[model samples]
Each structure stands twice: as structure tokens, then as C-alpha cells.
Target chain A: MKAEVVVIGSGISGLTAAALLAKKGKRVVILEQNRRPGGALKRFTRRGIPFDIGFHYSGGMGKGEILRALWKYIGVWPRLAVLPFPEEGNENLRIMDSGKVVRAFFSYDRLEDELQRVFPGEKQGIYAYLNKIREISNTIPFFNLDLPLTPYLHDLFSPKGMSLAQLLMSLIRDTDLHAVLSTPVFLYGVPPREVNLTIHASVAHPLYSGVYAIDGGGQAIVDAFLATLAEAGVDILTGQKVESVLIRGNQVAGVKTSEKEIYASHVIYTGHPTSLLDLVPGEIFRKAFCNRMRNLINTDSMFIVFGAIDDPDTLGDLTWINYYNIRTGLDIMDLDLRHPEKSIMINAPGRRDSDSTGASGGVLLIRMSVWDEVARFDQGVREKRSAAYRKWKAESADKMIEQAGRLWGDAYSRIEPLAIGTPLTFRDKLGLPMGATYGVRHSMNQFSPGVRTRLPGLWLSGQGTLMAGIMGASLAGMVTVGEIEGLEPLWYEVRQCR
Target chain B: MISDEQVYQQVTQIMAEEFELEPESLQPDATLYEDLGLDSLDAVDMVVALEKAFGMKMTDEEAVRSVRTLADLFDLVCRLKNRQVTKE
Candidate 1:
């Protein structure tokens, strides 16, 4: 196969990059390893209940927002159906031990009001933190959309040294308040102490601005991107794993997949940064550069239970609420990885059929976990795994269900474990090393790999390149494509879309 | 505290290792983009490498963009290191 550009990995980043490039008159081909596209955005059905794997809800979907502008520019906005979260109490943070629940509303004023209502003494600190997030997020060039691009690139590349923990310590004194404020860190899979302040602010500021869920879950997003790509005349080759990036001299010639070789001058790799080392020639990148990619720290993975609630009446308002149940007095920064039950996120993406009298709702029970928990069971593929691994996985799911039942009430006990995903499952399915949930950790301690590499035509995108989450990955695609076709013109076009 | 001479040596060493340039070729006046063949991407990585090597936060955008030669980088490192010491 021959094309002007070959984009490896068909995740949001890859799809976004392909759509944008194809729209700009470049012939693009997307090679995905799995049978289907949409890396994490892909959804599965078990017993007729659909569940989202990676995407749940996102921010910056409001009118005139960056995500909206980007999606509109890429032609996925009109096709997508976004349902905004309720104006009040979109997210509920529950401390299990104290039974204290703090709700976060959509708007800043309402969110502040709710916080002050919950923590009466910490009003001043809450204002400072939210204002800081807004201030920092406004300075981000693309995130702001109105800001000039060149001058702020330096700020994005060289982040401020202060970690989120340090910044929070300077403002807030209450420990529980700290946990509530830092709950958004789970979205990016970084601890508050290690996550950079600017990165955290960027992630949190959007949610504060607005939060919305897609109409049909993550698969809807994949369908929208696939339709847009098809309209743009971009070809998507699934079940083809890119084994190595074919290099001719100093430039990337194309890629060699498991099946065949596709020739193209420009190659965009949106996979994990470390995985790049195995695909490229040993001599292309310097020893230090290669070492940096290899030694890059990964974000923690998760142990997820995908099941359904047959009776929607059991849980009132099943659609809008995202529950973060944390063990009381436990530092939310460090989730107990050894015991997967310590901290859990319960999300119900609404009932399948709101009009049907017998409607069942899909619920995802996610516990943050480390790869070491499932390392012993990582010997084979998903189906071919040993019986011991299956037994361990079933046992782990039972414990998570038990914990969820204790904290979230008996509605969770009725949830049959239709599917369970461990770090091994993530590693095999998403092709991330150690099943690192968000790829490389964007922490204060390390520098994230740049979009451009030592190789002339090979570029990097996706979570590892920039930030994580749907918005972050989409921005990575925009940034990588912008780097190719001058940022000024692209930003100008995106601004016009807004 | 590290002296200016030691800082210069360490900066040059890091540059050589990171960019695969020989230490002998890293002259004080060698241009980063021209003589050393570094691009904009390399400049970003250079800041990260220097920051890690010196154990200091190189968040000064003006200093990073102003750097054109090996001497400029060494000067930036020295200034940043001194700034860290004074803050301490």
C-alpha cells in the first residue's frame, strides 16, 4: 500500500490526525493492530448491555470551547451527539469512612457554592485553587484558542516545576478538602505529589467549564471519527499491527506491518513512547534519547468490572452521577494498589432504553491498580490465559463487587460480572506496556517526549506525547498535525470554526 | 556549589551524550543549530537534559530561547544554578 502519510495506531489521536491530514489534501492510511479501530474508545457488548471501555465523560464541549472548535474543524462535531451533564451535582465524591459526600456542579460559581456548603471553613482556599486553575488554563495557547501560538509553546514544553501537591499545600490546609480537590487527578492517572500543576490545571479547568457525555458512549465517537475519515477518503486498515517503521537514510520511508509493507514519507506513531524504540533502527536515535524513552515512567492501570443493573429504578438518576468512592481518611493521592478495593470509581452511562419499561443500565466499577498485581497471570493472550489467571481475575472481581456493595449499597450486588479487565487485559488489547492506563506519566519529575523525533518524517502523538483523556489525545493530534502544516494556519482555521 | 568551570564541563558533556556529538567538537562558540546540527525539538530536549543534570528548574523561556551557542547554554545553566542557590 502507498500513501502520503501512514498513521500507526487507530486511537483518538491517530483518527484525529488522519482526519485532519486528509482534510488538508494528504492521502492518509490508519493501521490498527486490533480487529476494530478506536484503541480505548472501542466498546463491547456482553449479554446485550453495552459498556464504554476508555471514554466516559469529557469537558471543553461547551460552545466556543477548544474541544468544540477542534471537533468542528475536524468535522466530527456535527455527527456527534453530546448530552451535557446536569447543571448541578454532576460528580459526587464520597468518603467511605466518614460518609461525607461532596458534589461538584458544572459552573464555577455553583461548584464554589457547593464546596463552601460542604466545607464551610475552607471558602478562601477553594476560591484560590479554582481561580488558579482557570488562570493557568487560560494561558495555555491551544486550550485558550484565542491566545497566540508561538510564544506559549515554550510554556507548554517547559512546565513549571511545582507539583499539584505542592501548590495545593500552599493554598489549602484541610486534608479532606485536599482529597476532594485532587479527585480529578485520577482522570490523568498521576498522583497529586508527582503531577505537574499546569497539567492538572489544564485537565481540571475544562471539567469546571463543562462536562458532557456522548449519546451512545465511546463507540459513538469511534463511529463519528470513522465516518469522517471515510468521507475524507482516508483508509483504515484494521488487524494490521505495524511491526517496524521502515527508514531510508535519515527519513521515515513507511511502515512494515504484520501482513505487508506500506510506503509513505510521513509516519505518525500514536502508540506508547517506549514501544517506539523496538520499531525504529537502533542507530537513528541517540543512546540517551533511547534511554529516556525506555525509562519513562507509566501511569497506574486499573482493574475494571463491566456489568449491568437490570432494574433502573434501584438507582435514582442513573445517568448523570459519576461516583468516586474513596476509603475514609486515606490519602486520595496514593490509592492502595495492593488492595484494589480501597478506591473505586462507579460510573453508570445511563440506561440502554429510557422509554422501555424493562430497561437495564450499564455500570463500570473501576479500581486503580498497578501492573504487579497481575504480572503472574501475563503469560498469554486474553482467551489463552491459564486457569490460575482466570481464577485470580474472578476472585479479584468478587472482592471489588463486595467493596462496591459495601460503599454504594445493594444495587451493586445485583451486578453480574459480565467482563473483567486487568492490567494484562489492557496490555494485550490496547498494546500498552505493563497495561499503563494513560501511557507515560506526565509528572513534574520527567519530561514528556516531544511530537517530533530524531527521525525526519516520524512523529509522535497520543497520550504519551501530550496529555491524556479524550480531549488531551485529540489535542495531541491537532498539535502533531499543526507541527506538520504550520500551526499559524491551522490555528487560524480552528478559530474560524469557533 | 559547583563552579562556573565545572558547570561548563558538565553542560558540554551532556550535550555530547544527548546529541551524539563528540566532546571535542562541542566548542564554547559552536552554534547549536548550525555547527552541532540541532533542531527546535533538540532544543527542548536540551533544556530537559540540562535541567536534570543541574537539578534545577529551567523555566526561563527567555534564557532558553536566547541560547544559540555552547557558551550561551553554559551561561544559562550557571545563572539558573546561582538563582537556585540564592532562593535556597
Candidate 2:
């Protein structure tokens, strides 16, 4: 089959690129290796019950934000049911050890006011510190304008540029407050010290401002993309994996799969270019370009646990992001996600979803960062690794349940039917490099390759291409679309959508 | 209208409610996670309730590790009250 464009991988990036390119009037074909689309965002049923795989909670859905803007432009905004996150300082964090428990709440103003109250001596300093964070976060690219470069440079000069842990340490001399402020970094699936301020600011601000989750599972988001794609006249093929990017006379000729070869004048790769790097003959790519691609770091992998409890409505709320500092240690990245220091965070969607069937009860979504080998656990001894991973998830679940029990007591027992996946699942299923959830880490000085590759008509997209999560992928998609179809037209389309 | 005992009792009640424990079970020596089994999220929720109940602000540092026992939290209530007293 011949097409004007072929998009490999139907993940968020692939879908976004395909939909936008097709909107530009290009005949597009999308190839997904999975029988079901949505990649990590895909959902599966447990005993006829539907559960979202990687699509959990997100922030920045406020009016006119990047996420809201992208979804509205793509026409997916109408389909989602937006639920407000717990107000700042209303977020619940429960820490349990043995039989003892500690609870914490976070609201930005409340957090600031509380800090002043605690350290009356540093009242002015505390407000100044918090206000600085608020101000800097507001100035970030996605928050205000599309000047990704502005936030990037601001973070480079700011305290956050050093490292989240170091920045917090300098701001708050108090150890406990440092822990409190730094605890939320768990959501990014990385420890504070390893996470750069640029990445943290990008994630933390929107959340600090507001957070939201898509209604009827995240797959509806995929459905929305499909809706837009269909309207734009794009052809999508699921369950097809591209074997090679056919090149002729130093250009992308087409893509060859096992069953057939599809021709396209322009090829936009949503999957890892490294996956096809081996497939592309050496003579085609400039040595320098190949070197740059080879050196780019793939993000880390993660473990996800999703379940339906007997009383889902009674569990963690939609915006309930929790963290447990199992041990008093400075080495955040070294902490194993599979075996933790006794702290775990879990969220239940039933509490805040006033629109749910109530019978849908509570939806338990648990996430953790794991080693990348998780995706390759099925080949020979690798199969044995699956058992280890299942055990790890069970242990993690028990820890989560224990923490929840402290907060919800007997109500926690109602949680049941948990499904688990490790980084291996992401690697094998979604074609991620290391089962990494956030693409490559967006560090202070880390130079991310633009969507366009040296190979003409070949471009990159997705979290790995930019960063991870929905907003990042959408922005990456927009940039890729602009590059291919011309930025002015892309912006014009955006204006029209508005 | 709120007495010291009332504030103390309410603080204890927040712990009990958040941890799903009885007020009597929450002793001053009870460590949050080790004895009462509360995770970090519960700590955050407890702090929020405390803020509303006492009308006194609590910092993230104080909330994260300060309230280890029933007495530790009771003392926080006292501090919050002290602020009201000083203000008055």
C-alpha cells in the first residue's frame, strides 16, 4: 500500500503526528504492533472489567493550558470528563511504618501559610521561598507561552538547575520540610537528586496549579485521536510492525513489513529510531547523525498496578498523589521500586468521580520505576523473571494496602483484583527503549534532538523524542507537524481550532 | 470556645480518622508508620484536617516527620493555639 506518510507506533506521539499530518491533507498510514492501539495508554479488561494500563492522572487541564488546548484542538476535550484534583494542601499523603502512621496535606497557600506558622522565625523567608517557586514555575514554557527555550534557560540559571534535592536543601534548611517538598518527585518516577529542575518545574507547576484524569479510562483519549484521524482522512493499521524503513538513493523510499511493503514519500517515526537504525543500511545515514542517535539516552522503565476494588469509590481520590519515604536516605535513585523502604503511594479514582456508576467503586492505580529488563522477561529464563516481577508487585501491593489500611482501615480490605505490569511490558508492547515512561530525562544541559532527523522525510516523536506524558507528547506532535507541513499553517490550524 | 483539651482531642481525632484507629489506640508514643501504619498521603490529609480544625498553618517539614506520636501531634495543636493566643 502506498501512502504519502507512514507513522510507526500508535502511541500518543504516533497518533498525534498521524492525526495532524493527515489534517494537513497528507494520506497517512499508522502501524501499531499491538492488536489494540493506545500503546501504554491502552486499556484491558479484568474479568470483563476495564482497567487503564499507563493512563492514570495528569495536570495542566485548566482552561487554556497546553493539555486542555491540545485536547480541545484535537477534538478529544469534548469526550473527557474532567474532575478537579484535591485543592492545594488538600492532597493526602499517608506514611505508615509497622502500626504507626503520619498524615500530610498540601495546598499551595496553605502550604506556605503552614510553613510560616511552623518557622515563625523564618516567616518572611518561607513566603519568599515558596513565592519564588510559584513565580518560576509560572514562567515555564508550557505554562505561559510555547517558549520551551525560556523555561529551559531559566532553570539553568535558577537553583532548580543544580538538582531538585540540592535546590530544596538550599531553600529550606529544615530537613523535614525538605522531605515534604521533595516527596512529590516520586510522581516523575525518579528521585529528587537525579531529577533536573527543568523537568521538575515542567511537571510540578501544572500539578501545583491543577491536575486531572480522563473519564471512561484513558483509551477514550485514543478514541478521540482516532475520531480526529478519521475526520482528517487518515488510514490506521493496528497489529502491524514495520520491519525496515526502505531507502532508495539515500532517502526513505517506504517501509517494509513481513507481509507487505508500504511506500511513502515522507516517513515520520513515532517509534524509537534506534529500533530501525539497525534495519537502515549503514551507507544511508551520515556517521555523525548515527553517532548522535546512538548516544541519546532512553528513559527508565516503570511498574504499573491497576485494580478494581469492591468499593472503588471509597479509595484514593483522583488527584491523590502520595509518597512514602521508607528510609531516611539521601540516595533517592538507588532505592529499588520493586523492593522499597516501606513507603508506597496509591490513588483511588472513585472518591472524586461524582459521575461514576458508584458501582464502579474505587479504581486503584499504583505506579513505580523499575529496571528496564522488565520488558524482556518472557524469553527462557526471562520467563522466570516474570514470576519475580509478579512477586515484587504483590509485595508492593501489600505495602500499598498496609499504608491505605492505616488511612481507610477496614475500607482498605475492599480493594481487590489488582493487575500488574513491569517495564518489560512497556518494552515488548509499546516498543520503548527501556520501558521508560518519560522518554529521555529532560535535564538542565541535556540537548534533545528536534523532531526532524538528518534523514529527509524521517522524523521522531513521542515522550522519548521530547519527554513523557500526554502534554509533552502532544507538544512534540505539534512541533513535528509544524516542521513537516510548515509552522505557519500548523499555527493557523491551531487558531482555527480555537 | 475551643479548649486545649478540645483541640488536643480533635488532633487525636484527625489521626484516628485518617489512620482508621480508635482514639484510645493512638497513644503519644505511637509512631505514624511503624505503629499506626499511616503512609505519606495520610500524613498530608491529616495535616489538611488539622489546618482546618485548628486554623493554624502547618509546614511540609512539620507535617512530614514532626507528628510521630499522639503527643507529638497534640503538641502541634498546642503550638497552633499558642499562635492564636499570641495573635489575640
Q: Give the best candidate by lDDT.
A: 1
Instruction: State chain A's TM-score for model 1.
Output: 0.96
DockQ of 2: 0.01
Worst 10 residues of 1 chain A by lDDT: A350-359
TM-score of the second chain in each model? 0.95, 0.79
Pairs clashing within candidate 1: none
* Per-model TM-score on C-alpha atoms: 0.92, 0.73
**Residue A47: error of model 1 in Å?**
0.7
* Top candidate, metric DockQ: 1
Q: Please, what are the lDDT tens digits per residue for candidate 1 over residues A66-104?
A: 888889998999998888886754678887667789887
Evaluated on chain B only, what is the TM-score of candidate 2? Answer: 0.79
- What is model 1's C-alpha RMSD? 2.8
What value does the lDDT take at residue A440 in candidate 2? 60
Cα lDDT of model 1 by residue, B1-88, tens digit: 9999999888888888888898888999999999998888677667767767888877777778899998888888898889889999
